[model samples]
Target: MIGQDDSRLHTAVLVGPEGERRRARKARRQAAAKVETDARRHRKVQARAKWEAEQAERRNTSYLPPAGEAGPAALRTPGRFRLPKHQDTSATLAGQYPFLAEAGLGNQGVFVGQDLYSGGSFVYDPWVLYQRGLITAPNVVLAGIVGSGKSSLAKSLYTRSLPFGRRVYVPGDPKGEHTAVAEAVGGRAIILGHGLRNRLNPLDEGHRPSAVSDAEWAMQVASRRRDLIGALAETVLDRPLSPLEHTAIDLALRDAVRSAEVPILPMVVDRILSPNTADDEDGRLAEDGRLVGHALRRLVAGDLQGLFDGPSTVRFDPSLPMVSLDLSRVAENSTLISVLMTCSSAWMESALSDPAGGQRWVIYDEAWRLMQYPALLRRMDAQWRLARHFGIANMLIFHKLSDLDNVGDAGTAMRALASSLLANAETRIVYRQEPDQLGSTALALGLTGTEQKLLPGLGTGQGLWRIKDRSFVVQHQLHPAELAAFDTTGRMTSDSHEFRNLDVRSGIPNDRRDS
Candidate 1:
């Protein structure tokens, strides 16, 4: 009993202290819980008030629309809120216009016409562009369908440049269309044909460049003669010359050049056909050149005779404002056409090579026909590459850009040569093209879909001028006299030859001849 009583007393003492300690811990915990609840409630109330204030501020605020408030700034509309579209002049909108457009080839150069897009005057000069560093190459390629006024644009480009001290050289005018212009500009057209008495000797030492010494001139003359013979033979042969044939040609040409002061093609042909007996030790020289001789014989005795067989009847005067070789008479003969072009191009080469030969315009109308022959194409390519050095710009006018693909089979050297011509040119003028040609034209020129669509709709005298990366839709303008001179519709007139009389409203005559 005593032990149990003592244990109860110890237990009671320990239990009493433990109970107080537990109550104190519970009270501290309850206080902490209450403080935490109060802090959470305060935080929730503050957050709700802050959110309400933000909502009120947002609800009360008002701002301008995304389309903008006024003027050109009003171009944009906010949140699909619509604003009526207003039309304005491009000149006015250009202040901050939202679209891209041709800024006009600047205010310099020749005045071509008005830009149909920017509504500003469009000026273009290859030399001026090159001077401005707008183009590295001053060459131009103009393509348009027939009756699309491409010829007039070509004529205008050179004729208009006359005042700028730029002379024009039409090496071979197949249609004689430029003859009148040549004469009108105080230039001469060397007309050649079976009946007409104009002879162009390929051996004639053409315009002697100022830089060429007498000895150099002699060498140049020899080289030109050899090249002319080779080109003529190749054109006629429809293939490049063989090595043996080349050897025969070199010997024959040297002999001919040494034999005469002004060697004619007939001498070369005779020498080629029947080589010098001394060099014919093997008797196979004639056999080697038999084919080549006959091929070149065509230029002197075959279908290409009478044109380049004798000494040139007319001279190529670089001093003239323009010089054109009229080849309309023999237009029916393709071989003869190529031969004439070759001879005339060679004749122009001398003047072209002259450093003193001031800036000139070389126009190649109906470019498709001339590019057919490999020899002529090479000559043209050389000229194009040397255009800048010669102080001249070459303009190759085409019926269509697709004509380039027709040059040769794909991946062929001819095709590559043809494509390089287009590549070197930075300024490409595309006039009206048929729908069928739109895709190829676009691909060749990198035209946008909109531009490709615009091709078929372009009217006469209107063209898409792509000057580098910039573009312009130009409507070419001309004076009354220019219109009359550039008219190509005379042959397409009505069947009835009825004449319409013009009443002399002013001091004019019914027939233009009366003036």
Candidate 2:
């Protein structure tokens, strides 16, 4: 009986041990499965986060803000990281804020120091502090590459300034883009050419004679004496004209123009080209004089009547905001056209210098061509000097940095002369360019890191804009119809019923004959 009971206990102990081992194995398997499941969940979360980050980058790179949408301050990041307001006033004081934004004024108006933007976007709102007021400074230099939309930007600004009752004059460069703006804004476009009749009856007979007095003629003749001397020095002395030499030449030219009985250009040319003048002058001066003489003679005899007479041909109502000189027809004579435009500017400045009741803006497109001419350079220099007094604001546009260098040493001097204009400009806009040009442009405009980064990505009509205290890149949205209205061919086509119906003639008007 004892032996049987012992056997039963042993059997029970073995069964209990087996059951315990099985239970341990099951728990181990469950633990391993939970670990695997956790691993999978973690990997899925990481992948989702990575996907979100990639999506944000794509959005930032390709997204354009909706028209009229305030520009974004911060780019989106992965997950739920909230960002502060994009514009932080921490650096800017609210009370004496230099920036002023007035959207109701002519589409959109932003005044930064002397820089003005019309039809500009809210993206540019951060740059309002940089514009210069008319009373503060006078010159603006726009440097960009071709097709960068510099001309379009200038035209838009000019049109915007119109409602403010500013007198705007545009030189008739080969690009006649400004003419459409002038016509649209109720201003006249004066086309200067031979046989063109004056639309404005400035003279009693509707014609102004080209003549000067005997004393004036004698003074003009005497003025050629310096040019003759310079020509003699350049030809004989083999020297370049110094600043003093240029000044003397200017005085001489002025005398000749003021004193001449007939057109002074011929006499001026004759004096420079004379053999005696060359003999007494250095070879360089003589060469330069000959070049000048040839250039002047061609200008005078050529179809340059339009530039000198165009302003008088059209009566400018002070109430009108814009005036464009259309010179597309004279493309063959671009240099001559530049000369004419310079002369017209001088005439306008003289007329507006004395208490012109309001402010004015004068824009020069393809300004590089004008830089090639000494007379135009001098005129621009004068504009810089007297901009404040005349309340005249000037915007000079160029396509390349090298273009400025093409105008000789005078170009260098002109660049220096333009420095004040650049410094005083309240706003500076730099469009996309080659990599090399990008650095130089950024340095010139004093852009920050954020602003600099925006340059490479900017599209057409987009650029880095610098105001006084802050800067950013913005895509400018312009009125497409207004932009399309100006033809690139420089011809005001009759396709537009309004432009066709106008009784304006092509070229500066001559004295009217009884018609």
Candidate 3:
């Protein structure tokens, strides 16, 4: 009876409100577990069904054989197709790949000729190139062997530029080649030599630009005269002037300026040799300028006397389309040629300084000869460096690139200057080069092996133009009239072709026979 009472108490506690809530929660958990189990079973069955469908579809599909189709439908060889691996530089690959030629400089410049690789028209203008940011420097270095059509190319370049409002100035023409072209284009060529009547007063005030003030013009004239006299003295001395010599020149130049309206070379020579009594206090000034005076006297009273001694007979007209100083008559005397070129270059500089003078082509023909003189080389270097500022393009024409190597000793200042001329000139036009010059030319121009090799095979009128980093092989085209005007081999070809007297003012050949 006691055990039955204890069991009834336990059952009563279990059947209380808390026990009832626990039973309800247990029932909900059982329902959720059954729902989750049904969902998992459903997912498994769906996966199985999808797998069976894929297996059936895969069995029905057909694929290509490992060896490809057979008979006439066969597209593969009997053996495995394979290609040998190849590798090279992009430069070489560019040439090997078809349809990879350069698009070339656009057609806004002067029409030069066709690009060999691109088979398209190749036009070039340094100013145009500079304007378009194709080149930084407006100077150009052109080298070629004789009969390679470099002269013709140069003539064509400048003459073609004339129609575009650019002027041509050949500071010195050693062979008188440009005389005809100058006159043909309505320009003047100042013919100066031992027997010629043309006189250039280095001290005379040169062409003054319209923009410069009178005070600035006077200062420029003074500075140019002083420098011109010093350069001439150095050319005659074949060395640079010392401080004492410069002082002597300056004092004597001042004295000459006060005494004369337009001082000629002789007047300056007189003042330099015999300085004023008041100026030479210690009597040492005479000795100081003795060597310089005697050196400059060469231009006034010595063998170089007749050319620069007197006042101006023919003036430098910068307004003309072109102006060339013909030095062919004095070609045999290299020293005289250098001296005359110095004066002519000075005259041209005054015109170049004029911002209103427009664009001009300053051709340094027979550059090898000009490079021999340090004074001239320095002047040329200055002009080249200032080309962009002066709104001009300077073209240096030479026989070979190695000619610059012969300028001075290894690592000398003159050599550096000569090399700088090449460095500054972003445009390099190389015509047919002799095989012996390949190594040095390639080294100087930074040409690739292929470009270097191409040098030897270039034909006449065919040049390898390296404008900045880009390259093009151009075949220069010329008109029939240009061919006749630019021909330099006439003397060798025709026995009757003689240099008749040229009109003093016009530089055109006349019937006046050579006296």
Candidate 4:
């Protein structure tokens, strides 16, 4: 009984300390739990207040309708935007979208007219284009049917260029269309024909450049005289001269120059017909030159005698703003016209070769007629090829591009030369064409279907300009004074002269326009 009681006391003492320690740990854990619950409650209250404020702000805020803002601020309509369906060419569509059209040749050149597509002022200057690297060839090929106002456009181009210090030279004006323009521009028109007093001595020493030495001038004159006489003979004979015939003509020319102070065609012809005893050592020189001599005699004593037999009554003044050889009076005689052109060409060659002669326009007005003669065509080809070297721009006006087809047989060198003219000219202006002419014209110029179609429907003064690969539809605008001066139908329309004083811009006097 005593042992049991001792064990019970020890157990009671240990149990009492353990119960107090366990109670203290439980109290500390309960205090931490209470602190965490208070912190969580505070966070929940702050979050609820923030959410309520955001909800209040949202309830008061305004918003746009699904249709968009009303009145002037509206950017969208309630209904779908629609229009009638349309279809047209890209060329026409470009007008609707301006960015689609060409930027156009800049406004730095001469004012030509309006660009139909871009609705802007169109300007063109071959020299300006060349300097800007837009074109390598300064030559221009202009083809248009009669009554297309092409003549007026041509006149305006060169005349307007006069103020820029450029000179004009019309080598052969078959219809004398440019005569009035030449005279009006303070230039001379040498009118030559059966009855005209103006004689063109082919042997005349032409305008000598300030840069040429006396020796060089003499040599140039001799070479030109020889070439002119030969070309004239060839044009008449309608064939090239033989080698022996050339030698005979050379001997006769040398003798004539020695015997005369200023040699003429008659002197050359006389010597060719009857060779000097010393020069004709073989005694067959007269026989050799018989055909050539007679061919040339046609100029001095034959049917074509009057114009080129004696000294020139008028001289070609290169310093003039313009000079034109008016072949209108001799238009009926094709041979005579060709001969006269040959002489004029010689004069032109001398002046054109001058390095000091500023940039000039060499206008071949009736290029078709001029191209018929082999000699003239060859000379033209040479000049055209050397256009850039001589600082001259040649303008070849044709009735149609197909006129080139008649230049020679299809595959001949003559035809090739003719083709090269158009090829070398990077600027081609095509005016109104007949319906039938479309194919050949398009083929010749490599025109697009749209461009070809545009040709037949073109109105007066309107043209399709092909500058290199780019294309332009232009309406050639003319000043009132220009229209009056460039009137080619004066004889056809009697009222034209009477209405000449009227302003063409309004088709009435400026005073009457407001009335």
Query: 91 in model 3: Cα distance from truth in Å?
Result: 14
Cα deviation of 245, candidate 2, in Å: 9.7
lDDT string for model 1 (1-515, tens) is 99999999999998999899999999999999999999999999999999999999999999897655887667764568778989886568777775777567787767888899867899899999999888999999999999888998888899999999999999999999999889888999999999778888888888999967889988888888889889988999999999999999999988887788888888988998899998788989988998998888887887677787888889999999999999999999988889899999999999999999999999998899999999999999999999999988999999989888778789989898998898888999999999999999999988999889899999999999988898899999988888878777766564223334444465333566466
Give a tens-digit lDDT track for model 2, residues 1-515. Answer: 99999999999998998999999999999999999999999999999999999999988896546653353554544469777865645236443564554342122343322212333434222112114232244456666676676677777666766655666777555656666678888887777655567422111111111354557645543443343334333432334566644553454454444545333344444545553432344544444455545544444454443233212445544445666777776667755465456545533543455464467777877877766655456667767667666676777777654455466564466576544446766556676666666565666667665666666666666665554554544555566675686435334344454554444674323333223
For candidate 3, lDDT tens digit of each residue in 1-515? 99999999998987797888999999999999999999999999999999999999999998888887888798656798899999897568877786787999999879988898888999898899899888999998999999999999999999999999999999999999999999999999989887778888887788999978889989999999999999998999989999999989999999989988888877777878899988999988988999999999988888888878888899999889999999999999999999999998898889998989999999999999999999899999999999999999999998999998789999999999999999999999999999999999989999989899998899999999998898899999988999999999988766444333456666666774343
Candidate 1: which pairs clash? 66-78, 67-76, 67-77, 67-78
Instruction: Tell me which of candidates 2 and 4 scores higher on lDDT.
Output: 4
Candidates 2 and 4: which is better by TM-score?
4
- List candidate 4 stretches off by more than 4 Å: 1-87, 495-515
lDDT of 4 by residue, 206-257 (tens): 8888878889888888888888888999999998999998888899989999
For candidate 3, which ten residues in a row score worst on lDDT? 495-504
- Where does model 3 exceed 4 Å of error? 1-82, 86-98, 496-515
Q: Where is model 4 poorest over a 10-residue stretch in terms of lDDT?
A: 505-514
- In the order shown, the candidates' Cα RMSDs to the true structure are 16.5, 25.1, 12.0, 14.8
Tell me each candidate's TM-score: 0.78, 0.53, 0.80, 0.79
Q: How do all the candidates rank in terms of TM-score, highest first?
A: 3, 4, 1, 2
